[model samples]
Structure formats: structure tokens, C-alpha cells
Target chain A: MGPEVMPLLENRNDIDLVLWQQDCACDRKWFLENVQGATAIIVMFGDKVDSELFEAAGPQLRVVSTMSVGYDHIDVKEISKRKIKLGYTPDVLSDAVADICIMLALMAGRNARESMAVVNEGKWPNYSWAPFLFCGRQLSSTATSQRTVGFIGFGRIAHATLARLIPFGYTHCLYLANPSSAPATARDAALAAQHHLQSVQRVDADTLAATSDVVFVLAPGGAATEHLVGARFLRRMKPTAVLVNASRGTLVDSDALATALRERWIWGAGLDVVTGEPNIAADHPLVKEPRCVVVPHIGSATIETRIDMATLAVNNALAAIAGEAMPASVEF
Target chain B: MGPEVMPLLENRNDIDLVLWQQDCACDRKWFLENVQGATAIIVMFGDKVDSELFEAAGPQLRVVSTMSVGYDHIDVKEISKRKIKLGYTPDVLSDAVADICIMLALMAGRNARESMAVVNEGKWPNYSWAPFLFCGRQLSSTATSQRTVGFIGFGRIAHATLARLIPFGYTHCLYLANPSSAPATARDAALAAQHHLQSVQRVDADTLAATSDVVFVLAPGGAATEHLVGARFLRRMKPTAVLVNASRGTLVDSDALATALRERWIWGAGLDVVTGEPNIAADHPLVKEPRCVVVPHIGSATIETRIDMATLAVNNALAAIAGEAMPASVEF
Candidate 1:
């Protein structure tokens, strides 16, 4: 565990704490042995919470708290069957992730990666200042006649992202609501009125792809959203549109988006998450694409947000161990 | 000139157009020879409009319209003496420059250059996702207790930048106004109410630097503001504060900023303009600072803005030639 969460677990007299002290990943053998007889376990994104680990912890383990919003690494089925309470940080990270979403959108649209690379490679001296050199698509609606911002998901993070765009004179907001949810006409109307947007409508994927000058992938990652922004979606997008992915890596197809960028199907892309993260090779197709600005999985890497998440995770574990309700429990 | 403005200059029956048909700088001899017997001369940022050029034009030079906002390159004193109407594109590019200001602030606060460089250097596979690794200061006020945004000059571009920050929850606005202007008590109050900000006040340079979470150097470039953000000002800033320059390069001392960043006196900086630009070496102190994100002067380098500037320059010159007031004339 990081030092941010260390103080919370240090002075507890009623409970014992075992931490993986090194910066590297904890040894599986060590984790299995240390988790024995523990009433609760705190895990991060890389640690898999499964039946094998739960069985090793015996019937005494009552809860599992993760310092992340995504629980894809956790086997929900096994935890549900065991009636183990699960706590995951959610709303605390929305602001940080939304901030990065806008950052990536601006970076990708403004050609920051390539332009900065030119400076870093010592090429600025030879480059002349022409009217058109390094010109990029403007993010604000002030310069454009019409600006449409589209989102794949309209949850907390999406709303936050929309709020940021409104000040930039984004006139229209289009989003694809979850299939399971009812129509969001009232919600859209309320948002439009509050932000003074031209209109906010829930549209079909095709319309969202075709009309949006900038598209944001803010959906969850899993089987339901795997490759949601593949070749078909890319092909339908405006040639001047910019795509930003700050949600989950799996929602986008790396190769397809790369090809789309190279072929000029879309203007550019800014990405924080990729299909396979931490392992994203330097020669990955998305990284190799000049129009693509790729970063490691750092959507919620802000200092304040990470500290808040750790504090919440520690408090949730403490509450569970004390036979009290967790502050942010994930319902089965 | 690029294709965007060619149509405006083409097919003019009554006008004689002398085109400098090369990508390189216009030769001095060619410019002097061609400018003679010319009624108007359209210039760019690097083209100097001095007494010698004015004399060479032989009283036929009715106007000098530059395709840029900055007139530091032009000899305004000589132009005024010769009664040459001066035109420059100002408000047209404010949106573009403002957009880049916000981009740099977010980029600096988020460690984009260094983090992206890590990925580009083939080091991602070896880097682990730690809770604190590459963690940066959050740009939004939502994550911060009290967010303060300060500006050295609060003119069109600065206000445009402030508008972009409102959605990010920047509650307080502080700026160092021009010394000649009256105290903006009523104006600041009106602006505060209009923007729904906590307060908007004109403060001193020291207070602006000390309290601002992000400081923007947006004042004009010249002797009056040279090295305004030097070591003393940088030392007064919060260790977590970020400095952004989208206005004039001469307003900031590059060496001071580099030293501040290296010594951890300031968190980071984002510069769109720097002193002695286009000639800035790759080994320059500011360029070598890991915390500094340096881009070639591209504050107004957006397709829409550039086209608008070029069109405005052409129209201003044509209007002057026709014995009419230029659209955006700079009064002597």
C-alpha cells in the first residue's frame, strides 16, 4: 500500500495490518499467506480478487475494498456468493477523470504531441513561422459557426465533461444513453437550459458519429462496450472531428482507430486508456500514429483525487471490519 | 501567402500585385525595389516596417497592414510620422490564443510533456502504475479548496481565458491591471457578478504571484514588461503554482523560469512564446527543463483564426488603398 493509506492502518489496536512494502507488485505467494485469517482485504487495480484468494482467506473475510472505480479485476460472482461487502471509490474520481478527458481532447485537437515532439527533437530552429504551420482545429465554439460535442455515455463523468465544454461555446450536446435506461428527454432539457446550450439530445450512435465535431468515449469497459468505437464508428465520423477516450481502453479498437487516423477518416485522437495498458508497447499502432496522443492509464492520477480515493478506501475497510456499513459499498 | 487568403487578392483589375514567390524570407533588395511605387504593403510578424522601408516606398505607401496582433516588429513612431494608417488583426485571434492558454495551463499542471515523453522514449513497459507516480496538481477547483486564477494583463484574451476557467470551478479571479488605468472597483464587481465568481479584484504583482494557483503572463511584449516574471516574481509564487505564457515572450525571463522549475520553486510552466523565439536553441535552459512545456509560437495557430487574420489584413489594405478607413486600424 502507498504512504497515503499507511497512516490510516498504522494506529489500529484492534486489527493487524500487513502491507506489500516494495514498489513492485506483491508476490502471489506472500499475498496468499498474509491474507489468511484476515477479516478484510484492500486491493488495487492489479490485484485480482477471485475465488482462489477468497478461499485462502477462509470464512472470516467479510469485505473487500478497492481503491479504484473499476472492479473488472474482481470476480463479482464469487464475492456475491460469499456475501462479501465490496467498496469501490466512484464519484471521488469523476472530477479528475473529466479533467483529463478535456485535456486529451484539447491536446489531440491542437496537435500537442507532434508539435512538442518537434521542439524536443531540436527542430524548432529550422522550422519557419508560416500562417498555416502547426495549425489545428479550434476546441472552442467561438471561432466555428456550429460546434457539436458528442458522448458515448452520459453519466457523472460525461456531465462534468459537458459542463467544461459549455464555456468554450459548444452549442450542441449529443449523447448515446445506455440501452437499459429510459429516455433522458427531461434530463437533456434541463442540462441544455442550465448551460445555455443550443440543444441537448439523446441520439442514435450513427447520428452522434456523423454530426459531432468532437466525440468522447466515456462508457464503461467490459464485454458490453468492447470495441464500441471500431472501424464502422470511425468511418462515420466527420473528417474534422476529434475523438477522445478517457473512460476504458477496451471501448476502442486500437488498430482500427489508428488506421482511421492515418487515412484521415478522423482528424485526430487523444487517449488516456488503451486496450492493454502498462503493456502498451512503444511501437503500438496508436502510439505510432502521428495524430494520436497516447498516455498511460492516468485518468484519475491527480494528487488530490488519488489521496481522496486512498482515504476513502481505508475508511471503508475500517468500517467493514468494525461491523458497520461501508461508506461507498458496491451493491450486488 | 497560403491558399486561404489567395482568393481575396486574386482577380483585382485596378490593383498591381507583386508577389514574393518563395518559401524563404523576402530578399531585402527585392522588397525595396518592389515596394517602391506601391500604395500599400501587407506584412507579417517578421517583416520590419521601418523608416528606410517607408522612404523607399516614396510617399505612395498609404497603409501598412500586418497579419498579426503584435506591432513590435513595426516602427509605429515612423508610421505615425509618415501618416501611414496601420491595421492589425486583434479580436479575431483572441479566441485561438485563449484556447491555447488553457491548453498550456492544463498541460503544465498535468505534466503532459514529461509523461508523454516517457511513453515516446519506450519506457512505459518498465514503468509501474504507482498511486503517486506522475501525479500532478489538479487544474479544476473542484479538487482544490480555493482556486485562484491570476493574470498579468486582463484584456480580451485574458478574459476569454477566464471564461474557459469558470466551468472548471475557478471561483476567484485576480489580475494585475495596467498602471495607467483607474482602480476597477465597479468594473470588477460587475464582472464578478456576471461570471458568478467569488470575487474579481485588481491586485498588485506580488499578491497576484503569491496567491495564484496558476499565473498567466498575458501582457504585451516590449521594454515596459520585459522580464516581468523573473526570479523575484517566480520566487513569490506557490510551489504548486503553474505559469503560462501565451502573450509575449519578452515578458518572461526564460532563464529565471528554468531555474525556478529546476529548484522546485515552482511546479511547472507552459510557454507558447519565449524571448528570442525561432532562434531558441534546443539546449536553451527553458527547453531543457523537464517541467516546462515549450511549443513554437503557436498561440494563434488555428486554421480558422489564421484565415480570419489573413483575410482581415487583405481587407484592411484594400480599404486603405480605396481611401477608406481600415476595418481594424490602430490609431496613432
Candidate 2:
């Protein structure tokens, strides 16, 4: 359980509490033994909720609330089979994640990794500023031209990011939404007008890869979306374009991205989540690239947002305990 | 001379070119000897333009154009005394610099320095993601509260930054404009209505320091403005606030800022320029702080922006040579 969620649940007299106090992921052995008869469980993103966990919990588990926006770590099929209600924090973290998305996009385009190293490694004294030293791709639109931004997922977080990008003078937006959804050209037109963009086109992945100056991957992480941004898509991207990933790590292929950056297929990449995060080392292919700016899965990490997510998760659990609807329920 | 500017001037058969071919700052002996008979001189920030250089030029110089925004390195008083036209690239690079201002603010507030170190230093393997492990202050406004932004100098770049910030839901703006400018409450109200912000007010430095959640120093660099953000100013700031400097490094006192961060008087600082830059080493106090994010003066170092600046500098010099008004001239 998150430390913030402890106080919110500790004051309740009607329930007995079993808290995992470690800052890291709960120990597997302890979690399996302690979760034996839990009526409801609060899980972090690091915890995998699967058949084994469900089998340990027995049949009385009525809720599994996660303190995160992504439920990819949870086994939705298993939860549904057990008729357990799934609750996850979503809307509360959209703004924070969107802020990081814009931050990463700017960092990637501006060559932040190399520049920061220059300052932190004591290279500035000998580093002379040429007319074009450390020159990078600019994010804001110039007076003469506008920039276009593309998104792989046009959901709540993407919309929030779009709102922030409009003021940077990005006049065109391209997005690849759910492939199965019906095309909404009229809706696209309305969105463009509303955001003051010249156009918001619903394009195929190839066109988006080729056309956008900045490509954002904000889609879900699942089997279907795994490796959505692979070699084929990357090779089609503009040589000077930037790719930002603030969503699920599995959506982007790390190997393909590393190669693309190494060979200059794409200018740079900024990632908040990686395929096997918390295990990404200095020698990791992507981290080794000077152009790739990687942070450890901090997409929704903000003081206020984290507290809100914890409170919401706790609320979802408490609501379930009271035989009430979870505040942010997943209809699986 | 800048490499880009050389090509722009080389093809012009009307003018003779004496180029400094080195990528670094020109040697003192070469510069003084070569500049003796020159009718015009173009300079970068590293090249100081004081009375000594004017004496060396034998009073024949008609124009002093710099390929930068800040002119503190130039002796503006001497230029005015000689009636020499001073040209600079201003409006062209505002968007780029403003983009960096926003980028720095986000980075400073998001614990970018330490978080990035963890990934770059091979420490992520043992790093655990707690609820508040790397959580930082959010830049965007939450549903419950709107954030306030303050500016030390409300000029072209600050306004551009403000335009970009509005989409992040910054509802209030406080600024310390030119001290001698008359009170313009009506102007402030109009500015607020134009941006759809709740309020925009010209306030004293003390009030600005005390009120803002983010403070941006965008004023010019000179004796009058040097150390404008000193110990007292920083002490007045909120403990959770962020400070960003993109304009002139001399405007901030580095030692005071370092102490502020060390003592937890402020949350973080993001700086593009620093006093005695190109000399700041790894042991520099600000760089030593994990909360401070310093880049080596890359505010306007974007490919397109630099080209535009170089081209503009060349054009300004040629226009002055032709006895026409410079495209961008600094008036006394």
C-alpha cells in the first residue's frame, strides 16, 4: 500500500488493516500469504494481479484498486472471471502525465541530455560556443512556419497535451485513434476549430509517422498495442522529428527506438516509461544514446497527483467495502 | 565570423570580407589587428565591444551588429557616442528562447536533475518507485486550484512564454515591469481579459517574490539589473516555488541561489545562462545541487533560430553599410 493511503485507512474502526509498509514492491511471499482472505486489495503498478493472486485471495475478493492510471499490470480477464470490481485512478493524473509529455517532447527536441552533461561533467570551460554549437530542433513554431504534432492515442491525456501544444503555435494535429472506431471527419474538423489548429486529421500510422514533426505515444499497453512503434514506423519518421512516450512502455519497441536514434533515423526520443523499467541500466541501449532522454516511469509522479490517486484508490476500496460503486470503476 | 553568416556575405561582390575562420572566439591579437581598418564588425556574445576596441578601429566603424539577443556585452554608451548603428537579432529568436523558458520551468519543477541521474548513472536497477519517490510540484493547474506565475521582466519573450503558459491553466500573472513605467491598472486589466486570465497586475518586486508559484527572470543584463534576484528576493519566495532564468545570467546571484536551494528556501532552479559562464565547472555551487537544472546557454541554440539570427546579423550589417536603416537597431 502507498504510504499516503495508510493514514486514510488507519482511522477506520470498522475494518482490520494489513499494510505492506515497504517502499518497494511488496514481497511476493508475504503478499501471497497475507492476501489469503482479503475482501479487497489495494495494489501498486508494480504488483501484478493475476490468477495466482486471485487463487490466494479465495472467492471473497470484491475489489482490486490500483493507484495508477494504467491497468495493464492487472489481469482484467482474471478479475472478470472472479466477478471482482476493478478500480484505477485515471482522470486525477491526466494533467500531471500531460505535463511530463510536453516536458519530454521539449527535452528531446532541445538536446537536453547532451547539454546537461556538458554542464554537469565540467566540460563547459573547454566547450566553446560556435554559431551552431548544441543547436537542436526547436519546439515552438517560428514566425514564418507552423509545426504539426501527432499522437498515437487521442484520449484524455492526449487532449490535455494538445491543449498545451496549441499555445506553442502547433497549427496542425494528426492522430491515430482506436483503429476499430468509425472515422469522424466532422469531429476532427470541430476539434481543429476548437483548438485553433488548421486541421486535425485522423490518419493512418504511416502518414502520421511521415507527416508529424513530433510523434507522441500515449496509447494503452497490451498485447494488441505492444510494439506499436516498431522499426517500420520509425523508419518512416522524418529524420529530424522527435518521438515522445509518456504512456505504457510496451507501446514502443526499445530496440527499434535505440537503433533509430543511433543511426539518426529519428533525431531524438524522450521516454518516461521503458519496456523493463527500474532495470534500465547505464548501458541500456536507449540510455546509452546521447539523444535519448529517459526517466524512470514517472509519467504520473507529482506530489498532488500522487496524493489524489492514493486517496481515490483508497476511496474506491472503501466504497467497495461498503457495498457501493467504486469511484473510478473499470467495466471489465 | 559565424560560419552561416560567412556564406551569406561571401557571395556579395559589393563588400570585402575579412572572416575569422575559427569556430571559437577570435584571438585578441588577431581581432585587434584585423579590425583596424574594418568599416563594420559583427560580434558574438563572447566578443566585448568597449571603447578600447572602438579606439583600435580608428573611428571608421559604422555598424556593430551582434548575432544574439542580449547586448550587455556591447558598450551601448560608446556606440551611442559614435552614432554607430547597433543591430541585434531580437524578434527572430524570441519564440525559441521562450520555448526554452517553458522547458526549463517544467524540468526544474519535475525533479529532472536527480531523476535523470538515476537513469544515466546505472542506479535504476536498485531504484524503487515509491508513491512520492521522485514526485515533484506540478506545473499545470489542478481542478481545485489555479497556479500563479510571476515575471521579473515582462518583455517580448515573457509574453510569448505567457501565451504558452495560459493553456497550462495559469490563471494569475504578476510582473515587475520597468520601474519607471507609469502605473497601468487599466492596461493590466486589459491584458487579463485578453488572455482570459483571472488577473494581471504590475506589482512590486517584494510582492512578486512572495506571491508567485513560478518566477521568471527575463530582464536585460547590466549594472542596474545585476543581482536583481538576490538573497532577500529568494527568501521571499514560496518554499515550493520554482525559479527560471533565460535572459541574462548576471541578473541572478549564483551563490545566493545555491544557498537558497541548499537550505530548502526554494524548490528548484532551471538556468540557461549563468554568470561567468563557459567557466562554470562541475564544482559550481548551482550545478552541484540535484534540484538545479542548468544547460550551457542553449536558449536560442536551435538550428532554424541560429540560421535566422546569423542571416539577420549579416543583413543588418549590409543594410548599415548601404546607409539605409538597419532592420533591427538599438536606439539610445
Candidate 3:
């Protein structure tokens, strides 16, 4: 167990006698010593909480709360068979994530980074004052007429993203969600009324991939959604379109996006989450792409949002240990 | 006089005369020598057009066009007396200038420069994410609510500026034009109604300077408006207010504005036309002020807008030469 999870373990007053493991190593010594005589476990994504770990818990473990949204770190089916509860925070960080989404959208579309580099390099005088020198698209201000704002997934964060776009002159919203979902939920109906939009639908990946002026990737990032916006999707986007990603980075193949931006198939991109965490290198294909804007995974980094998330996670853990209904329990 | 006006000279067939002479020393001398038997004379802001220049051209001088909104440089009294038709391009550049007005409003109110500097300087890592880090007052977008958007003039540009504010959450409009003139002519009443705004009224400079969340100087520049937004007006402005000057340079007292921005008396400011023009030094008082965003006179620099302005200017020159009414003429 690493030191990161040790603090949570020592501070457990309401969550009684739990197993916790942080990734210090990939072998049995760390895992076996960590889960002894525990009723619940808090694991990070790096830890392997498979059948072996579950069997080692000896049927005493009743709840598993991962510190991330994705539960691929744990075997959910086995836990469901054992009737163990599950918990994850989903909508709690929507506002924070939406903030990042907008930040990326504005930064990438406006070419802020490149402009700043020019200012830093003290080349203002050398640059000609041509009308279109750095006049990037101004995301749907009142002064503009046509706009096409798109979403890869119509989820809580995407709804929040739309709220921000309303003020910026976003009139059109195209969505590609799961085909089995209802055609019009209350949120979709409300958004339609608010924006005077045409319709919200679960279109094929190709339609969503093609028509949007600013395509936002807000879909789940797992095996099913991996590389959803690959070479074909990039080809479908307009030459002037911008792509924003605040969801799982795995949904986009970085190489494809980099190629699109470099070849001017797409205008630019803003990404808060990358395919791998903290492993972005100088020579990363996307990093070298001029139109690709990247930020450290700070989607849920706003102070207000982070506090709310922490408070909710603490309350859920306490409620689960006390045998009460968790306020935001995630069902497997 | 300078190379900047070479484009005007090369297209002499289209432009019958030039009006602005502020920097036309060498060029004016050369034009007078090479442009013999010309049908008209062009004057600028600083040069005085009197009976002598008209007499020099004799019967050939048929028109006098000033390259400015104000006719102070033309000696309009003499032009009217001479019965030589006058030409000025007004209303054509209003929307473009108004766009700059709103751009300044947003940039100042949102602290764009400061926020971007923070991000560009790598300060985000050292600072803990906070809720109100760069929050500023959002402009009122709804018309039903009365968040007053005031103006120093009630002309075409001011009306256009109000239209730009509709999407930015601006609801109300108050203006302080020349008290001697009516708030708005009957022609613009319908336009005012479209914005859900009341008729413009004349307010004292102090009162107009005090109440506006964003005060725009869209009035013509010359002796009358010079120092209109001086220290006295700055003293009356709200601490959270933003000031935008796109009409002319001398309307605002640069020293007073710099002091206001530096001392935090006013929130921020955006200036397209600075007082001294190209002579502004790197360490000029206004340039050093962090709260000020100075763009180098790019009011009508948009692709769609500049072509229109140049076309109108060319047409005005031709009309004055052909003894036809200029489509849009500025009067004294």
C-alpha cells in the first residue's frame, strides 16, 4: 500500500474496519497484507481488485468504492453475485468539467497559446497588421449567424456545456448518444425550448462525426468507446471545425486527431484528458500538432466543485459503512 | 505624406480627392506637383482648406471631401460658401466601429488580458484552484432587466453598440449626447424599439460618466469632444465600471485614464484609437497600465467591413467629382 491511501485508512471513524490498497508494487506481497480482515475496500485505478483479491477478502467485504468514475479496476460482476454495493461519483463534477470544456473550447478556437507565444517572442512589430492575421472564429457570439455545436454523448456534463454555449451564440446542437436511449428526455426537451433548437437525436457516429462545427467528446471512455473518433471520424469533420474533449481520452485516437489538425482537415482541438495519465511526452504526436491544445487533467479542478465532490464521497462512504442508503451509490 | 497613403495615390482614378492631411506633408507636396489639373482637392485632419487652395485650382475645384467624420479640418463654412459640394462617409463604418466597442467591453469586463497572462506565465501550477480567481461582472443580456448600458453619443455607432450588447446580457441603455440635440430622430425610433430600449436622452457628463456599467465614447472627435472623459468624469465613474473608446483618440484624457486604471478607480478599459496615434511610445503612460487593452486602431479591419469602407470612400470621391449626392455624407 502506498502512502496516498494510508491517510484515508487512519481517518476512518464512520467507515469501520476497511481494506485499502494503493499501488506500491504489482506483486502479491502488497495486496495480501492490505486486505486482511476488512469489510470494505477503497482502491485506486492502478490496483488490481480481481477475483483473487475478492476471494482473499473472505466474503466479509460488502462494499467497494473506487476513487474514479470507471469501475474497470474492480470485477463488478463478481461483486454483484456476492451482492456487494458499489459507489462512484458521476454528476458531482459536471460544472468543473464543463468549465474546463469551455476553457479548452475558447483557448483552442481563439489560438490563445500561439498568440501568447508570439507576444512572448516580442514579434508584434514584425507581424503585419493584416485583417485576418489572428482572427480566429469567435464561438457563436451574437454578431455571428450560423453555428453548429455538437456533442458525442448527451450526458450531464454535455448538458452543462450547452448552458455555457447559450451565451456564446451557439444555436445548433447535434448529438450522438446510445441508440436505445429515449428520443427526448426532459433535459433535451428543456434545451430545445431554451435554444429554439430543431431536435436532439441519437444519430449514427458518422453523422455526428461529420456535421458539427465544434464537436465535443463527452462520451464514456471504455472498450466500447475506445477510438470512436478515429481516422474516419476526423475525415468527416469540416476543415474549420474544432474538437473539444473533456471525457475519457481513450475515445479519440490521438494520432488521428493530430493528423487532422496538421493537415487542416479540422481547425483545432482542446483536450483536458489524454489517453494516458501524466505520461505526455515532448515528442507525443498530439503535443507536436500545432492546432492541438492540451491541458493537464484538471477537468474537476475548480475549488467549489472539488470540495463538493470530496464531501459527497465522504458522506457516501460513511453511509455505506453505517448500513444506510448511500446518497449517490453507483449500482453495478 | 507617408507610404501608408500610397495605396490611395495609385488608385487616383477611383479617388478624385483626399481629405486627411495630418501626416500628408511630403505626399501632399508631391501630389500638388504631379496631380496638376485635378478636378478636386483632398484635405486631412490638420491641414486647413481655405479660399487660397480652392482659388489655386480655380474652376477645376468642384468638391472638398474630408477624410474624417468631423468637418473641422475642411472649414465647412468656406466650403458651403463656395458651393463646392462636400462628401464624407458616415454610417458605413458604424457597425465595424461598434464591434470594436463591444470587443473592448468584453475584454475589459472579463479581464481577458490579465487572465491569459496568468495562464501563459505558468502561474496556474503554483496557485491552488479557486472559485473567484478571475471572476468579473458579466454584462446584462436580458432586455427586461435594467442594467444600464450608457453612451456618450446617440449616433449610428452608439445604436450599433447597443445591438452588440444584447447577447452579452445588457438590458438597459442610457445615453448622454449633446443636450441641444434630440435623443434620437424619428428614423431610429423603430431600431430602438427592436432592442427593447427607451429613447436616448441627454444627461450631464458627470451623471453619464457615473452610472454606466460600460461607457462608450462613440461621439465624433474634435475640439468639442476633446477631454470629454477627463479626470472629473473619471472621478464620477463607478469602481467596477469599464470604459471603451473606439470613436476617436482625443475624446479621452490618456493621463486620466491611465491613472484610473492603475489606481483601480475603474475596473478596466479598452482603447482602439489612442491620443497620439503611431507616436505612442512603448513606455507610454496608458500602455503601461495593466488594466488597459490597446489595439492599434483596428475598428474597421474586418474583411467584410474594410472592403465596405474603402468602397464607400471611393464612391464618395467619385460622386463629389460627378456632381452627385454622396450616398452617406457627414455634415458639420
Candidate 4:
């Protein structure tokens, strides 16, 4: 815990806190031994919150609060079955993640990675300033004509991203929402009018893939969303369009996107996440693709954002232990 | 010339066009041999416009149109003395350069270069996800508190940059305009109201350096502005602050800024231009600084912006040849 969160937890006579203090991942043996008699546990993305861990924690375990927005590491079904309250930090991180999405989009479209490589390789002096050299697509629309921005999932982060793009002249927004969710025409119209955009419409995947100048994948990671942006979707995208994935790596088919870039089917891609993250070697196909600007998952890595997340996680754990509702809790 | 510009010049019965076909710089010998009776010459940054070039054109050169915003390469005094019209592309590139300024600020503050390097080096798997690792300063003001952004030179590009930062919750703006220009109190008040800012004031250089969270150098390159951001100015800046220069390389003392970064005097710096042209070697002090996110001089190297600049340059040359007012002529 940071100094900010330590104040909230320290000198609490009612509760005993046992922190897995090492910077490295908490050893499984250490976790199992120390988790005994604990009423609640605070976890991170690295921890596996499965039935095995729950069995060791005993029936006294009332809550499992994760210091992240994504709970893919947790076994939600088992937690729900036991009626243990679950809390995952969300909304608080939307701004930070949205900021990175814009950065990636600009980096990919502007060829920042390749251009910086030229400077780092000591070849800039020899490279002549040609009229067309190192030129990439513009993020902002210069002309009066509309620029289209599309989203795979119109969630909180997607909405925040759209808000940022408004100033850049992204007049047309097309998003594919959850099929079960009701149409948000009235809301979309209000947003469009507020930002003075041409339109904001809920569209099908095919239309979004074909017409968007920039495509952002902000959908959740699961079997349903796995490989959502595959060969068929890549083939339909505009040749000049940029693809940015700041959400989950599994949403994109890495090999297909790599082929799209290699074959010049798309301008470029900016990705913060990949299918097998941390384990993605330097020789990974996406890493070797010159048109791709890949960064390690750092969507919410800003100092302020991380502290907010940590504080919220601590607050949620404390609330659940007090037999009260968490400020942000999973519906289940 | 690109394929788009070729149509504008090709097959013109009135004017014979001699092309410098190679991607490399035009040979000085070839330039002199062919320039005996040229009415107007379109030049790039690489070509020097001096008394020698004016004499080679043999008193017939009516205009020298550069396809760039900066005319530091042109001898303006000599061009004015010879009564030659000088045209430069300026406003058309402001949006592109402003976009790059924001990119650099975020990149430098967020350690994009260094963090990406970790992934590229295949060391990510070995590194643990610590609470404080890879965290950098936040670009946005998360709470309802104020964040100040300072500008070294408040010009078209500076205003555009300020417009972008408003959405990021920058509540106050401080700028140091040219000393001779009157303080824009009324105009600044109107701007502050329009952007919902606390204030937008014209302040002294020292105050700007001391209070700004992000200081942008958007001044022109000339003897007056040379080394404007050196050790004395840097010493007053907050250690958490970021310095971004997308305008002119000469506005900053590269060695001073590099030392500041190395010694942790400031948070980081993002520079598009350096002291030298295309000659910043790998061993260059600024390039070697880990806190600096350095790129080749590509502030306006977007496909749309470059095309517009080239088209405007061609139009200015044609206009000068026709003895009409050039679209963007510099007054002597």
C-alpha cells in the first residue's frame, strides 16, 4: 500500500492486516498460509482468485476487492456462488485509459515508433527531408468534411474517448454496442448536438469496419470478444485507417493484424495489450511489424490514477468488512 | 514533387519546368547552371537562399517561395533588397505541429520511449508490476484543483495547443509573448471565459518557468530567441514539470536541457527539433538522455499538412510569376 492508503488502514484496532510485502508476486505458499482467518482480501491482476484460494480462506471471507478494472483473473462464478461481495475499480481509471488510447492512435497514425527508431539508429543525419518521407495520416480533420471514429464497445471508456476526439473534428461516431442493450438514439443525439458533431449513431460491425478513419477496440476480454478483430474485419477497414486497442489484447487477432500491416491493408496499429502479455517476446510478430506502435500495458499507469485506484480498492475492502455496500461493487 | 503536385506543373505550355529528380539535395552546381534566367524558384529548408543564389538567378528571380513555415534558411534582408517576393507556408501547419506538441508532452511525461524500450528489449517478463513502476506525471487534472500550462511564445500554434489542453482540465494559462506586443488583458479575459479557465495572463519568463506544470517553447528561431531556455530558466522550473519544444531547435540550449534531465532538475523533455539539422548523432547529449523523447524534425510531417504546404508553395510560385500578390508573402 502507498503512504496515502496506509493512513486509512493503519491503527485500525478492529482489524488485523497482513500484507504480502514483497514487490514480486506473492508466493502461493505465503498467500495460502497468511490468508487464514482473514475476513477480506485485497488482490491485484496477478493474483488468481479461484475456488482453491476461496477454500483456503474459510467461510469467514466476506469480500475480495481487486485493484483493477478487469477481473478476468478472478473466478466470478465461484465468488458469486459463495455470496462473497466483489469489488473492482472502474470509472476511476476511464480517463487515464482514454488518454492513452488517443496517444496510441496518434503514434500509430503519425509513425512515431518508426521515425524515433531512425533517430535512435543514428541514421537521421543521412536521411534527406523529402516532401513525402515519414508522412502519416492526420488525427484531426483539416477540411470541413466529416472524419469518422468508430468503437467496438460503447462503454464508459469509449464514451470518454469520444469526448476527447470531439475537439479534433471527429464529427461522425459509429459504435457497436452490446446486442442486448437498448438503442441509445436520444442519448447519442444529445451528445452529437452538445459537441456539434454531424451524428453519433449505433451501427453494425460491418459498417464500422468499412467507414471508420480510426477504429478503437474498447470491449471486454472473454470468449465472446476473443479474436473480434480478425482477418475478415481487417480486410474491410480503410487502407488509411488506424486501429488502436487499449482494452484487452485478446480482442484482436495478432497474426491477422500483422498481415494487414505487412500487406498494406491498413495504415498502422497502436496496441497497449497483446494476447500473451509480458510473455510477448521481442520477436513477437506484432513487435516486428514496423507499422505497429506497441507499449506494455500502461493504460492506467499515471501516478494520480494508480493512487486513486489503490485508495478505492482499500475503501471497498473496508466497506465490505463493515457489512455495508462498497462504493463500487460488482452486480453479482 | 509528388504525384498530386505533378498535375499542377506538368504539360503547362506557358512554363518549362526543370525537375530535380533525385530524392537527395539538389546539386549546387546543377542549381547554378540552370538558374541563369529563372523567374521564380521554389526552395526547401535544405536550400540556402543567399546573395550567391540571388546573383546566380541573374536579376530575373522575382520570388523565392519556401515550402516551410521557418524562413531562417533564407537571407530575408537580401531578398528584400533585391525586391523579391518571399512566401512561406505557415498557418496550414499550425494544427499539425500543435498535435505533435501534445504527443511529445505526453510521451515525455509518461516515459513512452523508455517503457517501450523495456518491452522491445524482451525484459518485460522479468519485471514485476510494482505500484510505482513506470508511473509518470498525469497530463490531466483529475480533481477540481487547478493546473497551469505555460507558453514561451504565444503564437498560432500556442493557441491551438491551449485549445487542446482545455479538455484535459488545464485551468490556467501563462504565456510570454514578444516584449513589444501589448498585454492582451481584454483578449485574455475573453479567452479565459470562453475556455472556462481561471485566468490567462501574459507573465514574465521567470514566473512562467516557476509555476507551470508543462512549459511549451513555441517561439520562432532567431538570434533574439536563441538559447531562450537555458540553465538559468531551467533552474527555476519545478522538478515535476515537463518542457516541450516543437517549434524551433535554437530556442533551447540542448546541452543545458540534457544536463537538467540527467541531474533530475526537471521531470522530462520532449523535443522535435534540436540544435543541429539532421545531424543529431546517436551520441548527442540530448539523444542519450533517457528522460528525453527525441524525434527527427517532423513537427508538421503529416500527409495532409505536408500536401497542403507543398500545394501552397506551388501556388505562391505561380502567383509570383504572374506578377500577382503571393497568397502568403512576407512583408519586408
Residue pairs that clash (backbone atoms under 3 angstroms), model 4: none
* Candidate 3 RMSD computed on C-alpha atoms after optimal superposition onto the true structure: 8.6
For model 1, how does the per-residue alpha-carbon lDDT over B34-146 read when each residue is reduced to its tens digit?
89988999988878889989988999789999999889889888999989899999899988888899889988998988888777666788886667778888888655477
**TM-scores for every candidate against the unseen true structure:** 0.97, 0.98, 0.62, 0.98
Superior by DockQ: candidate 3 or candidate 4: 4
TM-score of chain B of each: 0.97, 0.97, 0.82, 0.97
Model 1 C-alpha lDDT per residue in residues A208-275, reported as the tens digit of each score: 99999999999878788899899999999998899999888899999999999999999899998888
Candidate 4 lDDT score at position B326: 88
Interface RMSD of 1: 1.7
Model 3 per-residue lDDT tens digits across residues A1-332: 22332455467664455332322323465666767666766554446677788877778776776545556666777888888887766676675566566657755665645653443343444444332355454554324356678899888889877765664446778888866777777777778887666665557878877777788999877787889889999999887778999888899999898888889888788887678645666567876765676765666643344444545555566567779998777775
Q: List the residue pairs that clash in candidate 1.
A: none
Once model 1 is optimally superposed onto the true structure by TM-score, how far is the C-alpha of residue B178 displaced, in angstroms?
2.1
Report lDDT (Cα) of residue B200, candidate 4. Answer: 95
Off by over 4 Å in 3: A1-181, A184-332, B1-34, B40-92, B141-146, B185-193, B197-201
Q: Which 10-residue window in model 4 chain B sums to the lowest lDDT?
A: B137-146
lDDT of 2 at B76: 86
User: For all candidates, what are the clash counts?
Assistant: 0, 0, 14, 0
Tell me the spans in candidate 2 whose CA falls farther than 4 Å from its real position: A1-5, B1-5, B184-186
| Over 4 Å off, model 1 | A1-4, B23-25
